[model samples]
Target: MMRVGAVAAMLRAGAAVSLSEPELLGLAEHVRPGAVCFDIGAAYGMYTYPLARLAGPAGQVHSFEPLPVPYRILEAGWRAIGARNVRVTNAALSSSTGYQRLRLPYRFGLPIHGWAHLEEGLKHPGSSAAARIVEVPVYTVDRVCELRELPRVDFIKMDVEGYEAEVLKGAEWTIEQHRPALLLEIEDRHLGKYGRDSAEVAGSLLARGYRMHVWHRGRWNRADRVSTRWRNYLFVSWAAERRR
Candidate 1:
């Protein structure tokens, strides 16, 4: 069932700053009416809020943010924006369903890397900010869909720090079921933090018959494999094995 509670959210530019990730342009451009979108790790509803607008009344957006503060902000944003089709949930998407110890950031902290930046701040010590570690519930896309009774997802955007692999792992069933396009953040430092390689992430998707593409230097390029930049990437799930 959809978690019921008061969540925090904010409205920016009236455009929904929650959907403010850099990689979504490619996916946003192709959005259609009645489309169903999922924004995993949706911090503060930047992606989720705007997507709720894009999808319009006919389309729907399922936004998941587990971090206590972020999840609250997401909920608030939904209420502030008042999109009838938007659904916000307080949970995380992962390769498995369980609890995970996560690093908490100092006030106004900037990520030294990706979502795993809290861990980096701890290891580096030279970081200007301090962090606290906390444990929270984790779940997978498949589990979320099953719990919410959602059948199809048109687009899936994930930015789970360095845990993209784990998120994809839990999404195997959903990937096969919805076959939606994916826009994920895959940086070398982030992947390295989790000891995962791009080949595994990219190869796994390719093997599943999803077409791959990458956003490079402001242009969207359809790549046969993962991009070399490793900063951020967009993986489009095409209908066939037409990898390019």
Candidate 2:
């Protein structure tokens, strides 16, 4: 028998229109005209649309969404807007190139696509959200850049649930080469599902000469504490910092 959420999802599967993108303060700061940007876990092209606008016609926005349903929606949304600068890919970014089980979790009998993740062992405590698994193609950020022959990368926004660390690992080469500003969504509850912690993720970037910052009071403030009220963090490399 199909789940209640699955039935509901099928009903809305053909809907190409995307919900309104949430207002994210400071997202425009990292993106610049003619810059190349990456939107990992780009569900329904929420950030992709805005990133493309900020990057302008000379810029490029590479969006990655692995799930079949969300991928379809994201593709349609971008196409509807005639976003010629945005390139949509139906794949997941990880530490290595391979296939992995993607967990699509539902809450209160409704599909919460943003909460979908790649961690199979994830257990959402105190939540009745059940997940259904699907195999997804995975590729490294380095591999994608090489395959695309990208000249440079300027900014990246990653929100792959608890898989941020794996994504960062795959993007090491790109980070070192381009020194692009990174905006990542990090939460302890999500990382704990994969037996990881926020410290480890922040440490990896910090060790790479990146300064962590959070958006507060309409500005980017240096994040002294790894964990902040806002789960999203901006990691600016020293090179980019110096240029700014």
Index of the highest-TM-score prediction: 2
Task: Estimate, for each residue in 1-244, the C-alpha lDDT of model 2 and write its tens digit.
Answer: 1232232233233222323322244666778789999999988765776677778788999999999998998887666657788899999999998899887777777777877788544555325458778899999899999999999999999988888888998998999999998988889888877778899999899889999998766678898557647778889997778888
**Minimal lDDT window, size 10, model 2:** 1-10
Off by over 4 Å in 2: 1-23, 120-129
How much is 5 displaced in model 1, in angstroms?
A: 25
What's the lDDT of the predicted structure labeled candidate 2?
0.79
Q: Best candidate per lDDT, number? A: 2
In candidate 1, residue 4 scores what lDDT? Answer: 16
The models' CA-based lDDT, in order, is 0.66, 0.79
Give RMSD to native, each candidate. 6.0, 8.0
Lowest-lDDT window of 10 residues in candidate 1?
1-10
Q: Can you give the lDDT of residue 193 in candidate 2?
A: 78
Looking at model 2, residue 214 earns an lDDT score of: 85
What would the per-residue lDDT of candidate 1 be over residues 88-110, giving only the tens digit for each residue? 87766677787776765565665
